[model samples]
Target: MATGPNGSVLVLTNPHDVTTDVVLRILADRQVPVVRLDPGTDLHTSAALTATYRTGDQRGTLRTPSRELDLTEVRSVWTRRPSPFEGPPGLGEQERRFAASQSLWGAGGILASLPGAHYVNHPWNNRAAEYKPAQLAAAQRSGLLVPGTLITNDPDQAREFATQQTGGVVYKPLWNTPYKADGQAQQVWVREVRPHEITAAVAACPHLFQAKVEKAFDVRLTAVGNRLFAVRIDSPDLDWRQRQSLMECTSIAVPDRVARSVSAYLSISRLAFGAFDFAVTPTGDWYFFECNPNGQWAWQPDSITDSIAHAVADQLENGPEA
Candidate 1:
């Protein structure tokens, strides 16, 4: 097998990531060098990285327990859910914060600046696509059907918009925030808005309200470079994630129009991988919901997981197709 300079598959993710574990196994089976780093734990603890630039050329090395990876020699980098940099344990809050900032820009920045290394979805690109409003706007521009949505901190405006939609509206957080109720962790799920539920508290923070699309099922399209895998998900709950055990997922074919839009969305977002969600109406029309640039895919069946793992490994081994 032909290998790149450093010839290593650098995977940046926490240890709990099953997706990364599966991909690592595939790369190993194929005899590709694999290096796993958890920035949160390994950055200043078990790993060391150094980057030097001189005469307009940059070079670096990343050393972990098992191997040393030449930054310039890396074939591809899989940037997954790396934990945030946390400084030493003994420092005060303010001092620790300062250290974290330095570590992030120092270590994280160098990783992001690796030359000739293909990032599965570049960290910058992943961050750019994280905004829900921007995702919706891009989807619409790509000729995908998007729900009529409103983002505001004005209760009056929110209520007015909710009343305007014939089928009623649903409220979703602009971004997910961790919450706890009665000492138990909870998540804010997309929920249909009741007429009486609209209140002045909506003015507290910016909220996203959209005309709820009546859908028979949800479709999750996982795009790996140019390969798109569509799955039909059926659930009785509005937010299927809340009741994953009750959901039935089946692999399905991507519609031509939807596929084109998916391509356009990825191009516009400058992302090589995206996990897209859609609401499929009874008539089969797909309404774009959002695309998670660094979304999870391990929960899928072996067929889907194997396909995704192969696609990712192929990209890492040979670099992205032109």
Candidate 2:
């Protein structure tokens, strides 16, 4: 089915992201008028936005819902890019600083006022999705095996948990953030641990510790609406990201149990999408690791692009009809 231009979509994102550009292109191809809202603008009121991006090309000088924006005409919003605001090309330091500050705070206020817009992935929902502990609990409730885990600031407790696991455990960062400077990338490595290492680990702060299960395979399950894209990620190293050249991934069917879990998890999370990571033990049992709510999908094989894109378009065009 083809779509006609009527309602508009406002995309609030960073200006420099290629992925954001691609999504905008997709939306444009569907004939939707897109309004780009930069992160660092004082956009709380619709008037501020109208003075900015809502202009001659798409819709000229027309009044939006508020002095700055007309929310009623906005059918959907995609929060694709997030970046610190930058001043227009040649502003001085003080003026630039002022603009950036207002933009940052205003963007928040504006987005908050848009309660009626259908958010593909809202900020609050995205924050909730990143909690690793919650994901593990949710996965287990859905009947997926989870490695024995511990969260504690106590050195003694940490050591005890490690000692009890059949094989020692692995320490994983709660968040998968990398520290980068000057374009030189230094990645944190995942390593096997002995019980004795807990003393130092506990000193760092509360750590997310898990039993290092011997895995036969790794699975990345990407969910879009009711459809599931399961891929088997195989590699020679403990951390696949460590050896991209040696890592291999192939499209694979989801086990019945996993498919069910994936569906249930998405429904419970109030999300239309998720990227789940799993470790399949030698015994063929799949253990849940975590799910990234704002996971990347373009890297997946092209075989599933039709369904994924279709699901997105359907949701945008026929949302909850506010």
- CA RMSD, predictions in order: 2.0, 6.1
Off by over 4 Å in 1: 1-6
Q: After superposition, how far is residue 156 of candidate 1 from its true place, in Å?
A: 0.7
Superposed Cα deviation of residue 90, candidate 1 (Å): 2.1
Q: What would the per-residue lDDT of candidate 1 be over residues 238-259, giving only the tens digit for each residue? A: 9999989999999999899999
Q: What's the CA error at residue 202 for candidate 1, in Å?
A: 1.2
Q: How do the residues 1-322 of candidate 2 rate in per-residue lDDT, one tens digit apiece?
A: 1123366676666656554565566667877677776545323223354323343323223243443445556766666656546754478899988877776565554664453567766666767878988888778778778888888888888888888988779988787677787988767767777887667657677787899988998888877667777888899888776886787778888889888988788767777668888889888888888899877666656665544555665556556321
Taking all chains together, each candidate's TM-score versus the true structure is 0.96, 0.78
Work out candidate 1's RMSD over C-alphas: 2.0
Clashes of each: 1, 12
Ten contiguous residues with the weakest lDDT in model 2: 55-64
